[model samples]
Target: MSNEQVISSVKDSYLVEKRRNQMIKGAIVLFKEKGFHRTTTREIAKESGFSIGTLYEYIRTKEDVLFLVCDAIYDQVRNRLESATDWDNPSVAKLEEIVASYFRLMDDMQEEIIIMYQEVKSLKQESREYVIKKERDMVAMLERMFTACLPETIDEQDVSLLANNIFVQGQMWGFRRWMLQKQFTLEEYIERQIHFLKQSLSTDHMQNEKTDQTP
Candidate 1:
């Protein structure tokens, strides 16, 4: 569902978007600190620099706030990825650039990512599904990028799986920061991951070509 379908009583499009952004920013802090189930709507309103009455003007329930937060975070990630990517030129080097950019973004958004993972289960079923679908869309974006760069001999299934692997590897830096950060700096992590991905892609393509020759 679109942000417009979030059931706001406010009619001004710009105002609705502005207020919701404020609400999302504040709600993320509270959700991270107290978690979604424990964070009260009144607290969210106050943190957002508004009153309970005004919060209700923009949302019917706290779940609406959560949905807005999740949607906003996803939008930010997707936009950053799209901007970093050069869609017109899909090459292995370009793919590596995208991977590094994505890993850096994941580092930048660590807290927000943690909040989403922790609180998304609190979202209503429909809202949860919508948020999940947004994630799938992101994976699909990576799949398209991989398909463009990888050899045709690579199975379609492997390309899809590789895309998912890249997506999760980016998030793993966030989710596993406690341990990973102890070992490698963010730059190191991104470099190593890019190296590994490039090697895997090259190895797979070579193996596929070798198999074709054998037959």
Candidate 2:
């Protein structure tokens, strides 16, 4: 194809993907505003301004819709963390950026994040696994970044535990926005957390990790 034709094709693909995302985002808003138990496929279709028939083109059930919403969230966090972590940057700065990206994501998509955090259990076993596995993948990705940042003295076990704690604690801030908002703005809250997070991944912990690894 000619360059102009290729460009046109790419643009068309982009618009299609954008519309599909809008449908999903619309559904997330409805799911958050009305709890998942009270929500129906028709409501999601109407909220998305797509016919119920067309909505089915993307998902077969309410569970499917929930999975898609959480998937979008996980995919975004995965991409953000991948983009934020630059090996060349100082470890502390990279850590701050990673945490900052997370809070900014929460601030911008509070409803979506809150919904997934609260409603993932509403899904069936398989659906829940799909979401939870993606969550784990994201944690592993961050842990890799943390590994690069940590001193060689830090052992695998401590780093693993710390990675889990940091991710869970960050999620809590988003899940409890009603209370956390009363305490601070999204940026202020994240900065304070990052400060403590940096201190927590201390040289002493690395030494402990090293000791644990002693053969």
Candidate 3:
């Protein structure tokens, strides 16, 4: 499901990974500026410090580069989330820490996140589906963490909604920063969001408890 599956004329695995990483870095900049359709493979090659011929050796088409970039970005986000989170001991405080970490990551990778959203449609259907599946996997990770920390009385559907909301809220900081950043600093935003999530969870747990107590 990664760009490793992309056809490469190069036989050396290390060189293939190295050059593809270079391609991903260069392509993200161009994609952010020109979009996927407007950017040319030659431009990607030049930006990546490879000739067109050398670039073709590693990728069959420009779509391949886009897929690589998307895959790399998702891998980075997931790896960072894994590192920041403590799955062994789930708690509300740990969930808040994970959400803050995710928002901070979104802020740091705003350009890459924007490019992924803007250019994802240009990818082939299979590649696009793969990218979407990766996204769902991350959301599912949050859902698992939420399930572990939330009260048992909370409905499954509400837990899923909470998990999805947390995921999108992190993304909103990147895609909607023009408005959000004008209104709040990053620390202020994280504090307000974490507060909102806690309030919602507490209210839901209280309601569920009341339902159980009803004769």
Give lDDT per model, in order.
Answer: 0.88, 0.73, 0.89
Q: Compared with the true structure, what per-residue lDDT tens digits does model 1 show for residues 1-215? A: 26564998888889999899999889988988898999999999999999999999999999999898889888987887788788788788888888888888899888888899988998889889999999999999989888887678878899899999999999999999989999999999999998888888889989988888995
| Model 3 per-residue lDDT at 213 | 96
Clashes of each: 0, 0, 0
lDDT (tens digit, per residue) of candidate 2 on 122-171? 88887687678888887887778778887766667777777787777677
Q: Which residue segments of model 2 deviate by more than 4 Å?
A: 1-16, 88-90, 203-215
Top lDDT: which candidate number? 3
Query: Which run of 10 residues does model 3 get worst, by summed lDDT?
Result: 1-10
As for candidate 3, its clashing pairs are none
Error of 2 at 156 (Å): 1.2
lDDT of 3 by residue, 117-155 (tens): 988998889889999999999988888888887778877
Between which residue pairs do clashes occur in model 1? none
- Using lDDT as the yardstick, the better of models 1 and 3 is 3
The candidate, 1 or 2, that scores higher on TM-score is 1
Ranking by lDDT: 3, 1, 2
Q: Once all C-alphas are superposed, what RMSD does model 1 give against the true structure?
A: 1.3
